[model samples]
Target: MSLIHCPECGNEVSTEAVACPNCGRPLAAPAPTIQRRVIVAEPRDDGFPKWVIAPIAILGIVVIFLLIAITRNNEDEANRTVNVNLATQRRTAEPRDAARDTSPPNRIDVPSSSTTVNPPAPPPSAPAPSYPSSTTTVPPSSAQTVPVDRASVVIDAKIATGAGAIQSVKNEKFYLLDKDLDAILADADLEPIEGNSLADSFGLAVLYPDRYGDFRRDALAAISKHIKYNATTGGDGRAAIKNVEPDSYYLFGITKAKNAFAVWSAPVSITAGENKLNLQPARLNEIAN
Candidate 1:
């Protein structure tokens, strides 16, 4: 057993006592021993951990690829179906179009050869009828005297004023009538007649005697009728009555100078050919109102 002494009380006590029995003093606690343990941590990286992130990213990529493949396959299937339908439609329409293009434009019908036909014959021509013969005969005559074929009479006239100088008259028309000379002359009223009145009353051949009977009556009436002739002065102061039958004739005419009218009368004879007469001028007298 070991013994120890208390300083305050000077008591003996066991070595392991916390307080002494003789003196009430507190004991000091012993210092504990500190043992140091060295712990080492592994070096951590600054970014995300590769173990968890690598698996998630790989799974995402695989899902995206699967979706794209599915979409492409669907598009190719739709295109193939459309192409097949178009080809089928074109094949179905070709035969009908070729038939329409190759059709004929016209169709002709042929007759059968079982029936026979005959042609008609031509008509006959008739003969022409014969014509009768014609003959001409001549009669014998006793005397061989040649008859006069044609005759013409030219009657010229001028104004016989007391003066020696002759005057020219223009635009005078004369008449030739198959009338009774004695009857016309017996009526004193017919001596101073106008040209228009003579043509109207006696149906006389009126002519403008400007060019010396170049425009006179060519034909005369038969000799059985009494003949009367007229003379008129032309632009050259000469009047002519042409193409008269060969006979004795009485002539009558009237000329106008200013307000006075001159009445004239004479006798003329025509032969086989041309016969010219220079008649006497009549007196100028006033016309009765």
Candidate 2:
């Protein structure tokens, strides 16, 4: 309801109001108005939902591992291929070496017999031509001729002491034989020198004289002083040795001449008759003059 105030002693008087209640102040002012404000509250969902990326991160790591595994497998396969090729090469090399080892040509075998055919003989060839057989004569083996060259040589050898003589010669002999294996002649001799001289038993020496009466100034060079005989006696009498090698010759020792020890004979043919060799001064010691 609307109300009024009394001045001085005014007091609120309702539409039919009366005296003031206390202090003579009347409640006559309209009731003061208050503004009311409306406030609305926003509803918030609980704390932030947790991030869900951990599973996706783990998935990425797995994919990376798979890629590495695939790459490693590829590398292993390549290595295996290379190893197989190397093994094949080694296997083939062995047989290649064996084939090379077996390649040399081998000896071949041949059959010994062959077949042949014969036909009936034709009419006898017109009178076989006659030839003279009497004119041709085959020479007897003993009469066969052989050619040889001869050289004559004279040698002088001496031994100063008996001891030296013993050392100088063992046994000596002369030999003569033809190509026909027949003996021509043979002999040997030894003798003593009457007087001796020594500038001290200096060993014996051999000397030679030229056909011109001059002595060989180099005596050793001109003579072979080491002449000796062999003891074997089984050789043929005619040949001195059978089946003499082609063109071989013989030499004989010399005798006489001061300090002479040997004489060399001329090389004779292995032919008939002319094979005689004379051992000078006789086969036994001759009287020294």
Stretches > 4 Å off in candidate 2: 1-50, 93-289
Model 2 Cα shift for residue 92 (angstroms):
3.1
Off by over 4 Å in 1: 1-148, 162-164, 176-182, 185-233, 286-289
TM-score of model 1 (CA atoms): 0.31
lDDT of 2 by residue, 1-289 (tens): 7666666565565644554553455344446699999898888776754465787779999999999999999999999999999999889867755553444322112111111111112324422222211222212133222222221211111222323331221123333322111011201111111121110001111221222112222222222232222111111211122223333334333222233233324343332212322222211111121
lDDT per prediction? 0.44, 0.31
lDDT of 1 at 149: 34
Q: What is the lDDT of residue 126 in candidate 2?
A: 27
**Best model number under lDDT:** 1
Candidate 1: tens digits of C-alpha lDDT, residues 1-289: 6777787888887767888878777555446899999999999887877688889999999999999999999999999999999999788767744553454311111111111111112225322222221222122121222223334444445554445445543445444444433355334344212332322222211222221122112212221244444444445544454445666555544455532344334444455444555544444442222
